[model samples]
Target: MLKQNLQLKLSQKLSPQQIQLMKLIQLPTQAFEQRLKEEMVENPALEGGKEDEYEADEFSSDDYDEYDEYDNDRIEADDINIDEYLSDDEIPNYKLQANNYSDDDEDKTMPFAANVSFHQNLIEQLNTFILSENERDIAEFLVGSIDDMGYIRRSITDIVDDMAFTQGIYTDEKTVENILHVIHQLEPAGVGARNLQECLLLQLRHKTPTESVDLAIDILENQFDAFTKKHYDKLLQKYNISEDQLRNAIDQIEHLNPKPGGAYDNSNKAVEHVVPDFAIKIRDGELELTLNGRNAPELHVSKDYQEMLQSYKHSRDKSTAQKDAVQFIKQKLDSAKWFIDAIRQRQETLFVTMNAIMHYQKEYFLDGDEAKLKPMILKDIADLVGLDISTVSRVANSKYVDTPYGTKLIKEFFSEAMKNDQGEDVSTIEIKKILQTVINEEDKKKPFPDDKLAELLKNKGYPIARRTIAKYREQLDIPVARMRKKI
Candidate 1:
């Protein structure tokens, strides 16, 4: 089997610089800002105005013409006044053009950013009770076990076992139980419960005592599956409670917050604003394209660098060390040129690819409808732009677009099409839409099972299997009919 073989194959691989360019193109606004700040920190040549210089240098300038001609920062350009000579009585012929604001406008527009985070909420409630460092550590350990949904899915014994093995902290069942008891009493009261019974019971314990609430808790403890599955008849005989009383208790239980940790302040977390990598505007039935301002500064081979290179080359009377120094400068100059050329190439390639996308989905952008989105993929754009599919993919990934209707992620317009029995291409997204509509309209008391849903779709001409229906349902995060059932 181990015979010598000779085979010829053609292959292509992206250079490291090309790969870096692709990653640079794909970053959205917030990440791009952070990246820009990091680059300014790293590279001395690349810089914006210093923090202290911003306020003083802005108003201390009388040469308005000079500022208009040479201003590099796109954001700072917005502050300049073009209507300096205009008066109230004068009819100004040349209107001042407004600069397009960055997508970070929404972030600036928002009032408050505080939405709850999982950890902060737990920590606040934990601080109210005093404990020794070890006890607090155990309590913190227990709090960590609770997930986003606020259920401690792992057992206390498992936590003790993990502490002894992984953390090298030997803890017993009693310590964990005491901590669990404290955590279960924390706000969003049902948090730290190991199972549904414990979660609901912890919630009920905090409620004002009534016959029905107590009875409901007992029913949940004894016949959880029946209660969950909405077997009201079996529960009625078991508990001797009327439907009205049962409904009341269920309502109260439903009102309790399942995840307390989800209610804490989540301030100062920066959200990503969809700054489009490319802009396509329709003016008088013609499409106009512009690269987003955030992509780069007015970059060129630095004039200082060019002069340094020239001075280094012109020096003839030199020692071996001087020649070596000249050679090192020459190498840096070459690298700088290559980088400048790569940047130019990147701009050109981006424009070409976006032009293709605009042409491909012109109807969708013009009208602003998902249904108008045509069947498009990487290959379609690649062929149009005269680039390989992989190259087109690099451009499309993590990019966004702004339209008259709304800003959207550019990748959303591209979806794979599935052929129907009639051989017509239909988008998989359309299929998902149909599935969502069906689920929304279905009777909750007797929800259609996956098999029934499949048959229904087949009757309506989709003709998919039960397995496929199940897969799609799961993909949509719609639980099974049994889980969906309600009284």
Candidate 2:
């Protein structure tokens, strides 16, 4: 059954202006400048300049009531009337602040340069190989199928089918495999292998053969599982080699690059540099925070647009054209003022939010010590600044700050709290730092397992379990102790 009832409800929603401000707050310096330029292009009444002066003339409320007749961006032809507006000499007043960056301030140059793409380099190398036209087409098609990691993700059969249907060139898996063998011999030494094992072998085979190389290949091909699991005893017995020789062979394998595509010089793509939105400096044992002025843009209403509104007011006929002009002028003025005010509020919010973060992690800022970083969350800063959690999140998500230690993403300063054996709260970041150091310094011949790591931390006053240690290790992108083995 369908039923209807009347009930009162209270709901909250963000205004368009608020939404715009939120978006502006989240943008890093580079994106923010691009956004500012876009707004200036769309809204003629809004502009960038060094002028610091602004003035306005007041208008009656009844005059503005006429604007309510039109929908947003809709101007009625018949109902439009200018008889109610002011005389030729008078102009409408608006609320606004002058937006400006200094004309004399020198612009900071961003560091970037183009690099050759990985696929393009491979194609150029393929061009050097002499082949029949059909062979060349198949080779080119195969090269195109390779991924960023320098491995062909598609099957040879799929490539063959694709070449038949899309490229109108039919080829079998054997022909594809033969050509792939040729690509395997490319400069990267492992450019076209199907899997990690094959990739490593390709690189090793390309090098001049030696006793150590032969042993490494035997280990890789025959005892990969044992070698990867660090079953050292089984490997030593099977290879009939002393621990020193196995270690040397493993070292040779370790020197080979696994991610061959990463070895490519990406000179075609500009090296992107993170431009921090904030900077923290220490003076007189005090922490000072400053917004990177490089990212901050000055915005103001266009003076010319304001003057045009005034001009329409004087010597204006009570025609639809004059009313439409007034409507357009008024809309632009409102947009400009609202945008300028939103920018002002954005600056205030960013400062308040980041200042709170700076103080929250004050100890770390003072000493540049990861151990000193306190456990903080988005809600903590949001509550302190009387803002919504989402607002604080947007500010922290993409934002970066330059500190005494080095540049860091704003969110990197936040960590969950964990208690020590003494019942004192400590940062998860500090615990991770300690855990990482222990792993890095452990004897690689026999790396510390998670349980052993937990025990070690427990001895050092951290109350953690084996599972917790494993979780932290995974978060740090470190594999298990078995994978960390040297030989």
Candidate 3:
């Protein structure tokens, strides 16, 4: 079948520059700075820092649309014009500076101290133990198997088979288990324990055996399920202990480090610092929003590159090599101009979007109250700012804003609307906050279940279902009422 039909349907397509702009908009402060550095490195014509006063003002954001006119078609050397790039007009001083930060602004960068990793520390401790070549290899293998949480999650038989196959060490389960016991004796009290029960027992074993410590060990070993489930009456019946004695044993168990490896220096792990893209401050009972200075990096096209283009334009020789070189120079210059313009557009979009959000949730920002946050979605902000919903989402998803309360993810401010008893719309965030407050204030010995929580919220005009309460509770990271119960 042969088909050659002219299609006449209106369709929209994103230009390369538009695609780039969307990607740039999605990046948070830290990632955006990294992208900026990469762009400067990849495009030599794109220079960072302030441009000289004498440089041409040709690469303004207004000229960004001109980049679309450039095509891949072959160009004659005579067609190139140097006058377009070279001009006596000076770039505006305000355009050159970011003006986001002042001299008085404090540096937010934190220095992390390097230290031995958890596994490395264990290996060093393994060296201190006087083991034969085979035992040492088994021990090292076991140490490698230990996760960051300081637990050997694998079974003894699994380790045994792995050693025989991977390490070429034919060893039995008993031998591996024996070597594992040696690993369990390492520092941090419970580095090599297989389970929580084992981990707790290991820590208790290291402690100078008090009645409470011994009792705690017995509770963990004999009534491990009952202890974890907080079955106080069952524990009392089984242990034949008084309330105070049981309480002391429970306290001792609670004090033990369930995750021993967590105490070790985490310098080996990649540290992620929260560099907020926007800062929302209350200046004289009014909300003030400012983008991070790092986001507004001073970038300009290289003047020397422009000069090189000019020199090439004036030269009499119009060789193919010269034409190719000029084309490359023109491409780089266009790219630099587009990138600079993209950045400028990104800054404007971010500021404008965030400004709309700030004003939208003005009550929350002014008083630092989560309950004051209005029911807002991406479309609401998009409609307000006259941008696409996807664009608003891109800004909301990855960006963090520094607020008077704390650094908050921008998405946190947006929540689905729910009607109260009075038929007034309210944010789900407000309901969650209130729900959390109710849960926090409830009696630990008799924590409110989902149904009771629903009733309580209903009394407070929320009228949420039992299932919804449970959902919200789970979302808040609060366990079930049974899990929240105390001795």
Among these predictions, the greatest lDDT belongs to 3
- Tell me the whole-model lDDT of each prediction, alpha carbons only: 0.66, 0.79, 0.86
What's the lDDT of the predicted structure labeled candidate 1? 0.66
Give the alpha carbon lDDT tens digit for every residue of 176-261 in model 3.
98999999999989888999999999998999999988899899999999888889999999989998999999889888887888
Q: Give candidate 3 regions above 4 Å deviation.
A: 1-10, 58-72, 92-98, 102-110, 265-271
Which lDDT tens digits does candidate 1 get at residues 181-239? 88877877778888767777888888888977887688778888887777877877877
Give the worst 10-residue stretch by lDDT in candidate 2: 90-99
Query: Per-residue lDDT of 1-487 in model 2, one digit per residue for the tens?
Result: 9999999999997677778898988988889889889999999877775554553333334555534323465764334333333233222222232323355878777765555688888888887788888888888888788787788777888889999999899879999998988788776889887888888899899888988898889899999888777788899999888989888888778888787876775434566789888889999999988877644455556667666655665653657676677777767766765677666677778889999999988888898878999999888999999999999999998899988888999999888999999998899999999999999899987899999999999999997999999999999999998888775
Model 1, stretches more than 4 Å misplaced? Answer: 1-16, 29-124, 130-137, 144-154, 158-172, 208-216, 240-244, 253-259, 262-270, 280-289, 313-316, 420-422, 458-461
Clashes of each: 0, 10, 0
Off by over 4 Å in 2: 1-5, 51-102, 110-113, 265-269
Error of 1 at 217 (Å): 2.4
